[model samples]
Target: MIWSVISLLMPFNLEVMVNQGYLAERSGYWGFLLQHPLNSLFEGGLVHLWFLPALMIAVAIMALLIRQQKTHWMLPIAIGLYLYGEFAGSSAVVTGMSAPIYTRNGPFFSTLFVVVGYLIRERHILWQSRSALLLAMLGMAFHFVEAYGLHQYGQVFNTNDYLFGTTLWAIGLFLFLLAKPDLGRKPWGFSLSQSILGFYVSHLLVVIMMMNLARFLGLAGLEKDTLVLFGTLLTTYLLVKGLERTPLKHLLFR
Candidate 1:
């Protein structure tokens, strides 16, 4: 909701080409103000905002299946859908078709991981042992190999997330994390946690600003990236901290 409002107020500038010609420049402020909220709701107005809606759709489907006592069907269905999506959606070699509103393979691609998460939670899958951690590392290594091989063969898609290797790696890593002992609460933990959502949402904007700042200062290569990274993080942290004192904090960070 906050993002939708932000999109309406400050829609990111974009350029589109049509008929091998660039669109003529015009004042888009009012048009974007009218369209951005709807775009944010359906068409991923700010690109990163796509995650929320896609995850919502995926979770809603899973919840429905669970409510109907059909949990057993979820894994098979999710796996099948993921495979189909990999072969026929967005970066597919066959169709190369994607839903414009959701952007490149949205809920269908996300559903697989969501289902995996659900299974891990409900089934108590654990990976605390040394052997499990070793296996997880091996799985990640194999996924890297698989991705490289696919890229070499020109069969790789938009991302490795659709591949079985990635699924294995994700599951292994998640289990490994789950097996770790919890860190006891710290004095700054609550404040840090509250700032995370704001940080995630605002960091991209900070990075863009920092990129221009770096360029303006004539920084290049790794130095520029490092400066941008730390600069954005620090700026976002401070911004979140300051916003926390205002009533609008909940709208931005919640």
Candidate 2:
């Protein structure tokens, strides 16, 4: 959240779409706020960077509901919101037009997924890793099927992010990870994971630079993609590692 504020003030040179925001939303700091004064409440502070704020909202609501012992209402409400999101997103495919609203934000997705996690935890749910993996694969297959169907409808946009298949996919993969909690307990894993926050917030800077350099050098195909991907990861990881040793560590998490 704090880092994004920097981009709003300075000419961060980010293409407006970097946030997956409408072009009209681009403006100087004050103008940006004036354009969508309640943006953080709706699409988040920025659309592409919506996860943290969404997660925060979900957690806050869950905390309140859980304390009141009235969390059972969440599942039904979540279903309603999820259906609305799916309807809005999928209607675009059928109508050959943009959806009337973006429903991938806090109320639609974050609240639902967070409630699911809470229920799983509170109920002490468990699953076999093999079965979880099979479920994951099945969910992925369903997602592809849905995507292909939408493509046949002549929709040029990307896959819908909040389909039923996607929910199943998340549940299965999450259970799989929970079943193997020790997977990332190794020294190397600890070292690599320590700078996750730093990498996430700063990697795009290194990535866009590498992307342009790759294009300028006439790099193409998988080679160019591999270079851009790994180059950004290594560069950002090193920068984060260095920053971890400095005063900026106060601003960013370990």
Could you estimate the TM-score for every candidate? 0.76, 0.80
What's the residue-level lDDT of 110 in candidate 2? 81
lDDT of 1: 0.67
Candidate number achieving the greatest TM-score relative to the actual structure: 2
How many residue pairs of model 2 clash at the backbone? 0
**Residue pairs with clashing backbones, model 2:** none
Cα misplacement distance, residue 189 of candidate 2 (Å): 0.9
lDDT of 2 by residue, 1-254 (tens): 56557434433334453555544334554475566555545553344556767778778877887789888878887778777767667646665443334567656678788888888898999899998888889998887777788778875537467677888888899899989998679998888777777777677667766886786678999999999999998888888899899997888653
Q: Cα lDDT of all candidates, in order?
A: 0.67, 0.72
For candidate 1, the per-residue lDDT at 226 reads: 94
Model 2 residue 72 lDDT score: 80
| Model 1, span 1-254: residue lDDT tens | 67645644442332222222322212354445345454455534355666677788789889999999999989888887777665554335444654433233356667888999988888888876565667767777876776676676565534655555666767776777787746435768876876777876777766766876786688999999899989998998888789889998877877
